[model samples]
Target: MNKSARFRQSIDFIEEHLYEDIPLEQAAQAGYTSLMQLYRDFYTYTGHSVKEYIRKRRLSGALGLIKTSQLPLAEIAYSCGYSSQQALCKYVKSATRMTPLAYQKSETCYFFPRFDSETIRQVTVTSETIPRTIQLKFYYPKQRGIEHQAVAALRTLLPEYEGRIFGRDGEPREGLFCYELAVEYDPEVLNRLAGSLGQELTEVPEFCSTFAKTAVRSDESEIGLAWDYLYLKWLRTSMFVQDDGRYFEEYLCKGGEVKKLLLYLPVRKRMDYDKISVICCADSKFLVSSREGEQAEEEASAAVLKVLSRHHPELIRTAREWYVARNGMIYTCGVRLEQAIELPADSGAEVLLAAAGRYAVLESSSCSDREAFTALLDAWIQENGWSKEDLPAFTTYETGGQAEPDAITMRVWIRLKDVKNG
Candidate 1:
């Protein structure tokens, strides 16, 4: 019944089934609370949440086994609840910036058990070398709407890759997974997988003409690395550098087991602005700084979100978390401050709602992108002539004086006005 007792019960559950499949719901049941509540309280009592604690505990034992045995990575990974060895490498890299074998190679492998009794035993440590994490150069088109038709178009033009894709690997990834579709001529592949399609139907709906995309996978570490290879090392050296523009991954839902997704630099194909709004967030701090070879700021955004969720779960329970690869972290942004006006009036009773109502907001990215885009949105608003609704709450930051760090904030507000009337 008490918080302390519930925690002890949950910890006991973890201890008894250390090797068992520990889902969050199951762990929460031990404390007789909902999964979200369990997560909040557990993380409240322990710096680590339930899943994190379990992962560390498992990784601890995994290190022990690695040092004590010569088992392969798959075995080590499966034994520790990782879906694949690649997934294991992903998690390790996210936390420690190394792979199982690389960590072993650097001789930084140590198994420190949380329970005191296990530390008494002396064990011999062994090490090994590991292959580097491979970078995948995935190509896609810019238009989400034109994706499927473009894929069908590519098949029509390139007769070799026509019906089936690459060595008959079945369908090239379908719509749900396809980020963008591209076409480019590959001299190497011209002799390889080139052919004609059903020929262009001029009378048919206009499909933006495309070059056959030369999407290839190779081992590299970062996107910048891919650019260096493609531009500096390979581009000028190769005879014809012309290719169709590519729409690489601009957004990610959950990057899953990826470190850096390889991308072809976006170049203009038809000499025009693609009618697409780059949906960016309030701050480009992490994403922009990454280009300067800087790590993302000590990310408290999510931590702050956690605190917000703890206090205002309802507003953020349905919150979206976007995986921005360049930044190398999940951005669990609360709703746009301007969206607050859409909420039911009763929502204001909650801490977040009240906070949202009072916050002075700014859409940092909306400001950063071509000013015309925001102007476009404002133009639409002006054209509609609907100005009575107040601007919504937005999460914004401020600086009172130069004496202290700038406030990393959560509440911001927006004001909607009729330009013609005002």
Candidate 2:
């Protein structure tokens, strides 16, 4: 609902010098942004170019000046940052599609993001996206006697909850029990858990960990239709959903506090070409309503491909096709068999495969059914300044691969380069 600090800074400069010939160099210097970096950062967040923004602002101002002042058109143009009226009129027509005088005679003005209070939508501008440090961790199974003790231990950490812990009733799968721990993001919780576990738990074997900046989007929908859109953006573009990606939604003003819902996307993966897999899966219907899942599945691939075509469409120059498969929680992206471009053979692929980005990690709310989780993902998209353009092309895979659908976990993986960008 509001702009980021950088965008605000840009606007501050724009507002103060609207009538001046402010170039990209000046704005970048004022904000300490490199030219290329500034372009991507500004466009990604605001969805507009700096010059385009200035042009819009000028058009909006020119009409006001014409309406109320006796200033000459040339003077008005100069005051609005145009070096000459001819140049000004050309841009005005480019924007309004009519001469300035002609448009003024018709008493026209410019408006963007026109919407009512209830239906308001916001475009987010991110601060310079910097890498965050976090531990990439995995959880191994505990001994039989420790299972009960672990449950009791967890209760101490998350007490007063009515829901049953997964696998508490029956034998859970073996291996490490994946517990996401972060001292930086959740220092209090981490410190508390560490103290509670004490020296006795220090010997527990842990997985790997790393620090990286991840994308954090928040949405809530009865069906994960919106989440599908966000995924659509991710695949289509060279975007990253970092291991430590976080999500949170604000519900009210501080004094009149409102509910806040937050979720973290755990990632700290390396794109090892040798370990990377070109194929992965996701279940679309798991989060989205059956109808919505079907609708999203229909366009699932369109989502990711859009990004691929937009940025590295050249990747597709060899294999000009894409595909996605998902039923509820699982969605898979792969190339058509006929369009087999070179899959990586480097050691990096192996590393990538081991990392979270290597597989086709599909998200499902294991705690709830597909409908509930899908709806939740949708709400995230709306609140988090996300749109389909932000996600990858998505296609629903067929369901029931001889596995219990409910037991299926939510996972997705892509190459490190497919995601990690500033």
Query: How many clashes in candidate 1?
Result: 24
Which sections of candidate 2 miss by over 4 Å? 1-3, 112-422
Instruction: After the best TM-score superposition of candidate 2, give how far the Cα of residue 323 lies from its true spot, in angstroms.
Output: 43
Best by TM-score: 2
Candidate 1 residues lying further than 4 Å off, grouped into runs, are: 110-422
Cα error, residue 308 of model 1, in Å, equals 53
TM-score of each: 0.26, 0.30
Tens-place lDDT per residue, model 1, 97-129, is 666777665524332234211111111111211
> In order, what is each prediction's RMSD in angstroms?
23.8, 19.2
lDDT of 1 at 31: 72
lDDT (C-alpha, whole model) for all candidates = 0.38, 0.39
Q: Give the local distance difference test score of model 1.
A: 0.38
lDDT of 2 at 199: 21
